[model samples]
Each structure stands twice: as structure tokens, then as C-alpha cells.
Target: MKIGYGHMGTLTMVVELLLEELGHEPVVPHRPTRQTLALGAKYAPEFACIPFKIVLGTYLECLERGADTLLSGGGYGPCRAGMYGEVHGRILRDLGYNPQVIFLFPPLIKPYHFFKKVSLLKGRCSWFHLARAIRKAWTKLTFLDQMELLSQTKRPRELTRGATSKAFERGLTYLHQAKSLNEIIEAGHAALAELDQVPVDPAADPLKVGIIGEIYVQLEPFANHYIEETLGHLGVEVRRSIYLTSYTRHDVLSTKGDMSSRSLAMPYLNQKIGGHGQNSVGDVIRYAKLGYNGVVQLAPFSCIPEIVAKSLMPYLSKKYGIPVLTLFIDEQTGPTGIQTRLEAFVDLMEQRRAQTREGARMQTGSAV
Candidate 1:
């Protein structure tokens, strides 16, 4: 079957690879655009979050492009994301489209159901083939995450403006077109080498910023108005608290780390609170402890969990002595406004750093 899914940064490309490996035609649409956002907002529920609207538009575009099936991730808890697949299916059916909709839930929740769904999508591929395909996809996903983090680190230090971004884009293209394990490895190595070639200032001390927020807004550039790229251009190093691989490890693979988000957040939030609200709190505390200059929280407008996280920002900021900026995004959010806020935030971070250095110098002089 011809399958379609939403545009989520490098994730769409990974899903495309997976579908192709399973012998199905993948109808991936272009990255989320203004037109796509408009179409989705026009059809989605009035109060539905931005991600739902954007994905709905993506699905419509895919269906128009001849996709017979739609695939989406499922959620659990107080987050509304768990209902997205069913709602999207209903909307499509009401609009007279009858494409099959599949929701891939976490395997640990319902192993039999998850495997059954996977078997359906695997089509004629044997179990071993499916395993190989998944391995290749996972490898590509991990590489993409590393590539992004590298770009963020390099962007602020590159001697030439936009040099790191240009190299990063080239690397993404190389990985996107790669079809084999060897090719994937080659693309990764070549990409990393190209990034390493970008001339960087050894003495440049860029402001360090950690981004904590809802997964969709954090990962999807269009949704967050390309906040990471904007920050990078402003000479700030950005670190995201979430990535697909990280999510897979924590949620899908159930790999427990020494410091889980829940444990970190328990002192403050003490409950799941749906979505990444709890994680946001935990991640902010972690960022502060790691000595980041500041933190930015990106949440879809009206997102409850993020709202809760935002509400706690002042407390976190005051106690941790780190600045926090909360941005609520929606269809009405403009790039200009976001740019202005980011510029101001960068300045604030710089001022804080300068004052910190002055204080340390004064203390040393007094001791002497």
C-alpha cells in the first residue's frame, strides 16, 4: 500500500526509508509550509494543538498525492496526542476520504497489537527483513540526531556566517538519499567530516541555551518558527532536550538511565501531568545544573502540560538562578516576533554572563 505520514524534521525521511524497506510506496510531502498550515487549521478542531493541524494538512497533501494509507504515532496519558489518529481518521472519513489509518503505539503497552500492526505494514517482508530494515532506520535516526547537535555546536563558532548551516543541509541530503547500511555509514562519516571542515573560532564563547518543550514544537522547525536555526544565527549554541532516538530509548525501548526525567522532576512536579510537562521541568533543572546560560520553553498555544511547565518557570528560574523564556506558538505566531524575542533573550544571557565574570574577577582581586 502507498503510505503517508506527517513532516517532522528528519523523521519523515526516516519513516520513508522504513516504508521503502517494507516494500511499500511512501508518499512523503514537502516540509510543512504556510499553505499546509492553513489547510490543516481550516479543518482541525478549533482548540486542537498546532501539531494536529499541521499533520492533518500533511495527510491531506499525501492523500492528494495518491497515498492509500496513513501512519501516525499514538500517545497515552492526559496528552491529547493519543486521540490524534482517531480524530484524523474521523475527519478524513467525513470529508469522503477512506484511506486506512494506522496508529503505532508503544510496543510495551500492547505488544501483540503493536506487532500485529507491524506485520500488516511489513507486507511480504520476512521477520529478518523487517529487523534489518529497522536496524538501518535506527542507525540513520541516531546519525541524524548527532548531526543536528554538531550543527548547533558549530553554528555559533564557525568563522563564516551560515557556513555550518550550509554544510549541515548537504549532510542531510546525503543521508536522505542513502539506501544501504554501508551507504548510511558513509553518509554519516562524510557529513561529520564536512562539518569538521567548517572554520571555527577557537576562542569564541557563545551563549549556551537549552530548549525544553513539547516534542512536536521542539523537533519541528516550522512549528517553532525555526527557533534553533535562528538562535544559531544569533551566535548561540542550542541543545534540545528531546530527540526521536531519545524518545525511543526512554519510551519504546524502555532503557532506564541513571537520571530519569521523572526522578529529576519529582521534587517539583511529582506527577506525569501529560505530554512533556514533567520532563520540561526536569530538563530545565538539569540544564541549570549543567551550567547552561539560559533555557527556552516552546509550547503549542494552550498545551496543558507545557502550560503547567510554564507556570512553574518563575520558581525554577529564581531557585536555579537561570533565566527562562517561554514562547507559546500557534498559527498566528510570526517569525519577526520570535526573532525579536530571541534577540532580546540572547542579550539577556550575554549580560548575565558578563556580570558573572565581573563578580568572579572582583572576588579574586579582593582575595589578592
Candidate 2:
């Protein structure tokens, strides 16, 4: 089987590796581009989240390239993502393309069904081989996430514009081409080293911002207009609340630690509202406690779960004393508009931080 999946940041690379190891040919779609978004938006339901449209477009591209199978993640909640596979398949069939669509749900929720689906793809590969392949992919995923975290910290302080981004991309390329576990480890170390070498101003005290919202928008640069890079260019240190590794650990593996997002969110949201709504609320509170300057919520227009989270933003901001900016994204969301809003938000954070420092100083002086 020739398998195809959507471009989801570095996660795509991991999927590609897994498919190859499973003895299937992987049809890697190009990263989401303007044309890709247009194609997806054209066929997808007008009200569907932008991620659905984009992934649909990705599948269309894969089909055009002769892919026979489409793989996607499924949700088990009120989120619209649970219906994506069915909807995507129907749309493709209507358009006269017949491909096998597979949706991987959380294994913890339906282990038997999940393994049954996995068996279909494993084919001639032994169970041991499959396990090894997954281990390798997981390792690569961890390293890829580490590189991203390093880039987020370094990008804001780098003296040369785009230097950290370039190094980060180079590291991604190296890791993607790596054929062995040793190579993967080497690539990860090399990538971090290169990022560390980028010249940065020691005196630069960049504004720290936490990103929270729908996973798709948080992870996909195209979906969010490359907000992380944009924020870094504006000299803001950005940290995302989700990554594939962490999501898998907490959501798929069901191994929530004592300070899990669900636990942290109990004060604001008592239960899961579907998608990452609860996590968004929890992570924002977490960031505030960590002294982040602000938090940005990215959600697709009409995303129900995110909308729930957005409704509580004002309350969260006021109680936490942290500024919150929510950006609703769609195919029509333009970079210029996002950039302007980001600049204003950053300025607001900066002013707020300065005032906080002055207040602290005045209080200390009065006591003295």
C-alpha cells in the first residue's frame, strides 16, 4: 500500500518513517502551501475547521500522486475532528477517487480496534519489526521536539535575523535523511549545537509568551501564519503548550502526571470540553504561574472547543494578571493582519512588564 498523511510539522516525517518500516510505500505530500489550502478550502465543508480543509487538500495531493491509502488521526469527543475521516472519504469518493482511509484513534480508548488497524498496515513486517520501527520513530520525534524547543528560545535572542530558523531547518533535513538511530541522535545533537552557535545579544530580555489552543493551529506553521517565527522575529520567546511527543504521552498513553493539564484545568474548566480546550485553559494558567509575559490562543474559526476556551480568556487574563490574545484563523486569515495584531500584543506585554518592575521597585523603596 502507498500511504499518505497530512503535513503536521515534524510529525509528518515520523509518520513517513513508520510507514516505510511497515513495508508500505510512503507518499509524502508537500508541506502546506497556498495552493494546498485553496484546494482543500474549495472542497471541504465551509464550516469545517481549517485543519480539516488542509488535511483534505493534503490527501487530494497524495491521491494525485498515486497514493492508495490515507492515514489520519481521530478524536473521541465533541470535537469535529472525530468525523474527519468519514467526511474526507465521502468527499473524495464523490469526487471519483477511491482510497482506503484509516483513522488512528487513541489506543488507550480502543486498544483492540487500534491494533486491528495497525495489523492491516503491518503486512509482511513481523510484530517485532513493527515495534522496533515505532521505537525509532518515537526517538526521532523526541529529538525533533527538542530542536523546536531550542529554536524557540534561541530565535528571540539571535543577533542575526533568521539564523536560528535556518539552523533549525537544516537540523530537520538532517534528521529526516537519517537512516539509523545513531544518525538520528547525531543529527539532534548537531542541530542543538548549531542553534547554540547563533550569535545572540546577552542583554536582550525578550518578552516571554506562551502559545495555547487547538493542536492543529499550534503545531502547523501555515495554519497559524508562522506565528512562532513571527513572534521570534519580534524578539519574543515563545513556548507552545503542545507537541506530538507530549500529546502522545498524556493523551494516547494515558499517563498523565500529577500536574497534568486536565488537573491544572480543574479550577477553570471542570471537565474535558473536547479537543484541547481544557489543555489550553490549563496551560494558560500554567504559563501565568511561570511568569510568562502573555499567552496567545490560536483556533480555527468555528472551532467549538476553542470557542469555549476563548469565552473564558477574559476571566483567565483578569484573574491571572496576564494578557491573552486569541486569534481566529481560517483560509482567509492573512499574515499582515496577524503580524499587526502580534506586534500590538507584544507591545502591550512589554508595557505591562515594565509597569510591574517599576511597581516592585517602588514597593521595595518605600519599605526601605
Candidate 3:
């Protein structure tokens, strides 16, 4: 079986590992681009969210490349994500590409159901092989996440603006091509080491900002116009509120973790509003308390959950005394417009920081 799946942030890497272990050839869709968006938007419902459009485009691309099986994560909440697979499958059928569609939305609450879903894909594999596949995937994920996080720090301080990014791309290529768990680990270390050697201003006090929004835009650089890297280029430190490893381990695999968003967003949103709305609200508050200079919320244009969260940004900004910038993105978005807004936001944060430090010094002098 040649398995193909739409990319969902870092989950694509993990899923690719699983398909290979299951004795199936993994069909990787082309990386998202303007053309990808155009293809997806051409056939997608006019009002569907960006992720749906992009995933559909990916599937179409995969189908053209001879992928016979398509996989998508199933959703169970009020979020449109829950119904994407069904919609995508129907779209594919209508377009004459009747690939085997698999939705990995097995009931996480029911072990038997989850195992059953796994067994179908495993074919003739033993439990041991399944476990090995999972372990290797998890290991790769850990390494990749670490390398990514390290790159975030280096992006702002590196002497050469895009050096860290280049090194990271190379490292990712090596990590992805590695055959075994040990090789993956070695590749990760090598990647980190290469990034570490990049010249950086150790004393650079870059303005720190936390990114909070829908998980897809927050994690997918292409989807969000590479907002994080843009911030770094503008001399801002970036921290995303969600990472795939933590999200998978805490939210999906285990139930024991401090979901600070639930508690932090209580004043404004007492209940889950679906998607990562709670995380959006809570993470902004958390970043404010952490002394971050500012917060930026990236949401897809017309995304209901993020739209709801965006409405509450003013209240959070006023309460925390921090600046907030919310940017809504769509295929029509232009990089020039995004870059201008980001530059303005960075300038605003720098001015605010200067005023803050000046006030602190004035207060100290008055006391003295």
C-alpha cells in the first residue's frame, strides 16, 4: 500500500515513520506553496477554512503522483476539523481519484477501538513491531522538536540572518533521511551542533514575544507566512504556545498535565470554545506574566474559533498591560503586507519597552 497524508505541522514526520514501519511506501505530498493553495482553493468550498483547502490540495497532488491511500486525522468536537476527512473523501471521489481514505480518529477513550484501528493498518505485524515503530517515531519527534526550539533562539541572535534557518533545513533533511532511531538521534545532535556554531550575539537582548493562536497556523510556517522567522528577522524572540510533542503527549496520549489555558482563560472564557481558543487566551496571559514584551495571535481568516479569541484580545491586553497584534491570514494575504505589519508591531514593542524601562528608572531616582 502506498500511503499518503496531508501535512499537519510536525505530525507529518511521525505519520511517515508509521507508514514505513507498517510495510507500506509513504507518499509525501509536495510542500505547501502558493500553487498548492491555488490548487486547493480551486476545488474547495468557497468558505472552507485554509487548512481544509490546503489539505485537499495536498491530496490532489498526492493522487496525481500515484498515491493509493490517503490518511487524515479525525476530529470529534464542534471544530470543522472533525468533518474534514469526510468532506475531503467526497471531494476526491467527485474528482475521480477514489483512493482508500483512512481517518485516524479512533476513539482515544476506548483502548479496544484504538487497537482495532491500529490492527487494520498493521496488517500482519506483531505488537512488538508496532511498539518499535512508535518508539522510533517518538524519538524522531523529540529530536526534531529540540532542533526546532534551538533554531528559534538562534534565529534572532545569529550574526548571519538566515544561517540558523539554513542549518536547520540541512539538519531536518538529515534527520528525515536517517533509517534508525540511533541515526535519527545522531542527526539531531549534529544538527544542533551545527546551529550552535553559528555566530550569534550572546548578549543581544531581543524583544521576546509569544505566539498564540489556532494550532495549525501557530505551527505551520507556510500557513502563517513564516511569522516566527519574520519576527526573528525583526530582532524579536519567538515562542510558540504549542508544540507537537507536548500536544500529543499531554492532550492525546495521557490526561495528566497542567493545561494552564483552562485556568488562565477562566476570567474571559470559562468553557472550551473549541479549537485552540482556550490556549490562545490563556497563553497570552501566561506570556504577559512571564514578562514578554508583546504577543501576536495568528489565525486563519474567517476561522470561527480564532475569531472568537481575537475578540477577547483587547480585554487581555488591557488587563495585562501588554501590546497585542492579531493577524488574520488567507490565500489572498501578501507577504509584503505581513512584513509591514510585523515591522510596525516590533517597533511598537520596542517603544513600549523603552518607555517601561524609563519609568522604572525614574521611579528609582525619585526613591533615591
Candidate 4:
């Protein structure tokens, strides 16, 4: 089946792997652009989150590609993601696209009680094949995610530009070409090997920035304009609080790790915050304790959870003594605006750095 899907951050890569195994060709939708957002907005529910709009655009593009089906997770719970698939499906049907919808995340008829509503791909593939595919893709996805998180702490600046990306591209290339599980295994090793050697400046002062906000906007480069790279280009230390692997693992497993640890479980947010709520608060606090100078909270225009975070962030800033910047994105969001705000934030952090050192020296002299 020829299908299309949206970017739930790096999960796209893993899903791509699974689709290939299922012999279902993935017609990757165009990266989020002004056009993509516009098409999505046109058919999307006004109250639905922006990610829904973007996903609609993806399906619309796939229809243009003559795809026979669309695959995406059904957003559930108090969060908008749970119901997005059905909403988008109706929108596509109205647009005259009759493609089958493969809603990956079944509708949760009852909270903490899954309803098993995979109506589309219900009988398409063997259960064994589907489970195996998920296992393989998830295995690679978890390792890649953890490695990336570690890279952020161990060498944030260098990996930012093209190092981590180069490794990822090379790995994906190999993953695409693999015909056997052993081949996938070999490609993973090579990918990590390439990733392990990214460059970094040992003397660079850690001017940490916490990434928080909508999951889609937090991870998608096309939607967020390669935000991590923008921070790295300015020579500011980047502290990542999100990764696809961790998010996926959190979804399946318990977040029982330490809140005090720098890279501990995302404990601050066990209960879903109706969308990026707890993550926003946790990132701000996490960055503060990790000695970060700034936090960047991303949100699409009209996202409720992030909007909630934006409202309460003033307290987080006052409590932590760290500055926070909110970037509300939409079709009109350009790389220029993002860069401009990020530059100013980093500049302020630099001043904070200067003041901190001056205070340290003053204390020493007073002691003398």
C-alpha cells in the first residue's frame, strides 16, 4: 500500500522503517512549509491543534501523489492528538480523497482503557510481521534517541551543526537498503559509530537552553526551522529535554527515573498536560537546575497546552531567574524570525555569563 504520514519528531524515521518492512511504500509528505501549513489550515478544524493541520496537509500531498492510503496516529485523551486522525480523515473525505486511513493510535474509548479501534489496518498485515517490524524499528529508535540525548550533554555544540545529522542521514540510508534483520543490526552499529565522533569545544562555557513545547514543533526541523542548529551556530550550549526515543519509551513504560538527575525520567509530567503542559514547566525548571541560562518554548498558534505554559511561565522565570522566550509558529513563521529571537536570547545569556563571572571575582576579592 502506498501511504503517507506526519512527523511526530524522529518517530517518523522508525515508522518509515516499519512501512518498508510491511511492503507498504511510505510517500513521505513534504516538509512543513508555508504551503503545507496553508493547505492544512484550509481543511483543518479551527479548534484542532496545528499538528493536525500539518498532518492534513501531508495526506493532501499524498493524495496528490496518487497514494491509496494515509497512516497517522489518532490523538487521544485530554490532548488534541487523540482525536486528530478522525477529524483529518473527515476533512480529507470532504476534499474528495477516498484513501484509507490507518489510525495508528487507537481511540481510547475509556481513559487508561484502550478500545482497540485500528479499523483501517485491522486485517491488512500479519500480526507477527507487524509486531516484529515495530520491535525492530523501536529498538533502533531507542538507541538512536538515547545516543542523541547523551550527545547533547557530552557535546552539544559540535553535534548541532551537521555531525549528529550526518550520522542520522548515513544511518537512515543504510537502514533503507537493508534486506535482513542482521543488515539492520549492522547498519545501526555503523550509524552509532559515526555519531560517536562528533566534534565539540572543551572550553566552551555551558549556556544551556531548554527546549519545550508541542511535540511536533519541538522535534520537526521543517516545522521548527532546525532550531537546535540555530542555537549551536550562535555558540550557546544546548540542553535537550526531548527525544523521540524517550518520548516513545515513556508512552510504553513508566517514567520512574529521578527528577533530580540531569537526564532523569521526565517525572514532572506523568499525567498528560492536555498537550505539552508538563513538558513546558519541566523544561524550564530542568534547564534552570542544570545551570542553563535560557529556555525556548515552542508552540503553534492556538495550541492550548503550550498556551497554558506560556501563561504560567512568568512564575517559572521568576522562580528560576532564567529568561524564557516563546515562539508561536504558523504558516507565516519563517527562519528569519526564529533566528532573530534566538540571537537576542543568546545575547542576553552572554551578558548573564559576564555578570556571573564578575560576581564570582567580587566574592573572591571580598574574602581577601
Candidate 5:
């Protein structure tokens, strides 16, 4: 089957590798075209969520380009993602195509169960096939994951011209090709070389903003109105809490820790907040310690976890002495509004920078 996948950060990487390794023709759909979104805008109900609209555009574009099936994820609980497969299927049917949609929902291991559940998706031949597929996927996933971890570590000291982006490009390339264990190894080695080749700038003042929030909004640049790039253009260095590898790890391994998992934005909120939002708080705190000037928290209009995060951010701001701004988006979100808020945030950061440097100069004068 000619399989088509929706882009979901590094998930696209994993899907492409699996399909190619399994000998299926995998078509990478053109980055959701304007026409595709227009079609989805007309076809989707007025009330459909933003992500559904975006994903629908992806599937529609893939189908037109000759993909015979839809390869995506599965449904779980509370989160709309759990039901995205069904919703997407219904949308496809309403529009007329009933292609095969394979969702790879990773299962969690339990006390009595030896293996986890792959919800709605089954291993082709036996448990052995499933094990091999998973093992192969992990080898690729982990290597790409470690590269990002290394980046955040070096990012603070390495924020000069071309340094961080060079590292990011390398990681993206390796992740783009991470298919099998052998490919994963080769890709990582090559990426490390690229990172080493790029030199960090000595005297660069990069605006360091920490982005924390819901996973979809955080990772999908288009969905977030290209916040990272916009910030970059303004000479601000944007760091995000969402890591492709960390999200995957939590998806497969953190079920045990999930119950105790706290809010991702503000620990003071102390709510499970549901979904990956809870885990993001730890990421935010980590970034604050790493010297981010401020944090901008984005949440879908009705996302409970992020709402909880917003509720507690005042305390986080006080405790950490960092500015925290929350942006709530919904169907009505427009580019102009996002642009305005971003400009304001950047302005605020500029003021903060001036104050810090002024204070430093004052101390120097006093010493002299």
C-alpha cells in the first residue's frame, strides 16, 4: 500500500522509516498547502478543533497525491487525540474516500501484562514482529532524542551566530532519515560532525524566551503562527519545552508516573491537568534555570491543564523572577493577533534587557 502520514514533529520521521523498512511506499505529503486548508475549512464542521482541521488538510492533500491509506495515531481518553482517528475517518467518509488508516497507538505495560497494547493496531504476524518493529523504532528515536538534550545543555553558552540553528538542522536531518538501527547510527554520527563544524558567535545578544504549553501548539510552528521564527527575526532566541523524543518516551513509558504527574506550567497548580501538559511544567522549570528571559505559555481555548498552568504562573513568576505570559488560542485565532502579542512580548523582553545591562553598568561605575 502507498501509505501517507500526517506530519507530527518527529512522528513523521518514525512513520516514514517504518513504512519504508516494511517495504510500503510512504508518500510525504507536501507541507499542508493553502488549497488543502481551504478545502478542509469548507468540509470541516464549524465547531471542529484547530488540530483536526490541520490534520484533515494533510490527509486530503495526501489522498489527492496518490496515497491509498492514512497512517496516523490512535484514541485514548480525555484528550481529543484519543478520538482523532474516528473523527478523521468520519470526515473522510463524509467527503467520500474510505482509505485504510493505520494508527500506531503505543501500549503501556502493566503488572500482569508482559506486552503493551497497540490500540486498534495489531502486530502483523505475531508478537515477535511487533517486538522487532518497536525495537527498531526505538534505536532511531533515542539517538535523535539525545541530540536535542545535548543542544539544550550547550544552547546557553552557545547562543552566538549560527550555533544553535546549526545543531537544530543537524538533528532534523538525522531525525528525517532515522529508519533502522544502522541508519540511525550513521545519521547521528554525521549530525555530530555538522554541529562541530559550525562555530558559535562570541558577542551575540540573543533574546532568550522559554516556550511552554500544550504539545501541539508548542511543536507545530505553522499552528503557532511561526512564533519561533518570528522571535528569531527579532533577534530573540526561542527555546521550547516540547522535545520529540521526550514526548515519545512519556507516551510509552510514563504511564506509571502519570498519576503522580503534576501541572506542566505551574507546579503550584498541583493538578494532573491531563495529557502531556502536566509533564511540561518540569520542562518549564528546567528552562528557567537555564537562563531564559521569560516564558510564553500557549494553550488551546479549553485545555484544562494549561488553564491550570496559567492559574499558577503568578507564583512561578515570583519564585523564579522570570516573566510568564499566557496566550489562549481557538478557532478565531488570527495571524494579526498573534503578531501583535508577539511584538508586545519582544518589546517587554527588550526593556528587561536594558534594565539588566543598566544595573550592570551602575555596579561597574560604583566599583570604579
Candidate 6:
């Protein structure tokens, strides 16, 4: 049986690796693009968010390519994400496609249920083989995350406009082709070392920006119009607040990292309001204290969690004296407009940095 899954940033790579290792043909559609967005948007309801539309388009492409089974991750909470698998499946059926849907819920909440669902895909692989596949898939995921972080650090400093990005793509290519844990580690190191060779502007002091919001919009460059690359091109350093590794550890393995998000957000947002809303607030507070120059919250239009978090941004900005720019996106979002806003934001950050340094000098003189 052929299996297909929608894109969730690097999660696609993980799913693809797992399916191949189990002796199943993984029918991954081409990466999400404008055409993918248009396809999904064509059939999707007007009110449905961009991610829904994108995933719908993805399944359609996969179905057309001969995939009979669909794999999707499930969520719980007030967030609409929990219903995507069911809703998307119905939409596909109504459109005349009869693909099988397998929605994998969070493993932590219901380990038995989660594994039972996963076991359905065991195909001809033995339990030992399945275990090995899981381990290899996880290794690839973590290595990819690390490579991405390294790219972010190098992007702003690269002397050539697209050098770091080009190297990053090459790194992903290497990782994607690796078949074993040792090979994955070697590929990661080789890729990082290649990035290290990209010429850099040692004197450049780029503005630092932390990205926080719904995981899809934050990680999927196509959805957010490649915001990270744009920021890097503008000589601004970018860091995402969430990555697949951290999410897996905290949510899947039940190993908490920096549980401080709850404590940090308590004053502004006291409870889990579904999705990553609380994390958004907490990330802003944490980044501000860590000396980041600014923060960008990228959320899809009509996203409840982010909308709720956006409401508290003004208060957080005032209290922390940090600038926050929230971009609400959908199929209608244009690259030109996003570029203009990013350029303006970067300029504002530069001005703020200058003013800060000047104030520091003035205070020093006063002390003398």
C-alpha cells in the first residue's frame, strides 16, 4: 500500500523516511508551492485557513500520484487543527477521491492508541525493523533541526547574498539521502562544515529577530513567503522559537524543556488557550530578556490561538520595551507587501539599536 502525508516543514522528511524503511512506497507530493496553494484554495472553503488549504492541495496531488492511504498528525484543544484530518478527508471524498486516512494523535496523551494506529502501517516489517526505522527517522529529524539552526546563524553573516541558503539546501539534500544513523551524523557535520566555508562579513552586526507563532506558519517557508530567507537577505539574523526536536521532546517524549514558558506567560496569559498561543507570549518574554532586538509573530488568518496571543502583544511590547510585528497570512498574501513590511521593520530595529547605544553612552557620561 502506498502512503501519502501533507507537509509540516521537516516533518515530511521524517514521515517519508519511516515509510521507506517499512518497505512501503512513500508518495510525497512535491514541496508546497504557489500551485499547491492554488489547488488547495480552489476547493477549500473560503473561511478555512491557509494550512488547511495547503494540506488539502497536498492530498489531492498525492492521490493523483496513486497514493491510497493518507497520513496526518492530529491535535487536541480548542484549535481547529484537531479536526483537519477528518475535515480534509471528507472534502477529498466529496471530490470523488476514496483515499484511506490515518490520523496519528499525540502519542503522549494516549500511547496505546497512538502506537496501535502506527502499528497499522507495519506492513511487512518486523517489530525490530520498525524500532530501527523510528530511531533512524528521529536521527534525521534532529540533525535537520541542527542544520537549520546553523544556517540561521550563518545566513546574516554570509558575504554573498544567497550563499548560506544554497549551502543549507545542499545540507538538506545530503541529510535526505542518508540511510543510517552514523551516515546522518556524518552528513550533518559535512553539511555544517560546508556552510562554514561560505564567505562572511566579519564586521557586520545584523539585527536579531525571534520568530514565534503557529508551527506551520513559523516553519513552512512557502506558507510565510520565505520570511527567514528574506530576513537573512536583509542582513537580519532569524531564530525560530519552535523546532521539531523541541516539540517532539516536550510533547511526545513528555520531557519538558524550559517549562518557564508557563511561568513567564502567567502574568499575561494564565492558561493554555489552545495551540501555541501561550508559547507565543512566553517566547516574546524570553527573547526580550535574552537581548533579541525584535520579535515577529507569523500566524495564518483566522488562527484562534495566535489571534488570542496577538491581543496580548501590545501589553508585552509596552512592558518589555521591545518591538513586535505580527503578520497574518493567507492565500491572498503577496511577496511584495511582505518584503516592504520586513524592510521597514528592519529599519526600525536599526534605529532602536542606535538609540539604545546612544542612551548607554549618555548614562555612562552621567555616571562619570
Evaluated at residue 360, the lDDT of candidate 1 is: 100
Model 3 poorest 10 in a row by lDDT = 249-258
Q: Per-residue lDDT of 253-336 in model 6, one digit per residue for the tens? A: 662333777679888888877778888999999989989999999999999999999999999988998899999999999999
- Candidate 4, residues 1-368, lDDT tens digits: the string is 78788856557667777777777787866566668878888877676666777778877877898788887765556776777778777878887878887665532233233334332343467778778877888776765675556455544556356675676567666655655677767876776777666666667666778887887888787777878767866776565566766665554343322233223214434454566676677778777877878888889888877787788788778977989999998766778888998989888988988999999999999999
True lDDT of residue 11, candidate 3: 68
Regions of model 1 farther than 4 Å from truth: 255-259
Task: Return the clash pairs for model 6, or none.
Answer: none
Tell me the lDDT of model 4 at 221.
70
Name the candidate that leads on lDDT. 1
Give a tens-digit lDDT track for model 5, residues 191-215.
7666555554557577788888877
Estimated TM-score per prediction? 0.98, 0.98, 0.96, 0.84, 0.78, 0.97
Is 2 or 6 the stronger prediction by lDDT?
A: 2
Write candidate 1's Cα lDDT for 16-65 as tens digits.
Answer: 99999999999987899999999999999989999999999999999999
lDDT of 2 by residue, 1-368 (tens): 99999998889999998998888999998899999999999999899999999999999999999999999887786787888889999999999999999988778788998998988989878999999998989999999899999999999999999999999998888888986778878887887888888889999899999999998899999899999999999999999998889888777778242256678889888878788888888888899999999999999999998999999989989998999999999998889999999999999999999999999999999999
The superposed Cα distance between candidate 6 and the true structure at residue 41, in angstroms, equals 0.8
lDDT of each: 0.91, 0.90, 0.84, 0.70, 0.67, 0.88
Candidate rank order under lDDT: 1, 2, 6, 3, 4, 5
Error of 5 at 158 (Å): 10
Identify the superior model by lDDT, candidate 2 or candidate 4: 2
Q: What C-alpha RMSD separates each model from the true structure? A: 1.3, 1.3, 1.6, 4.0, 4.3, 1.5
174-198: candidate 3 lDDT, tens digit per residue = 8888768888788878888988888
What's the lDDT for candidate 1?
A: 0.91
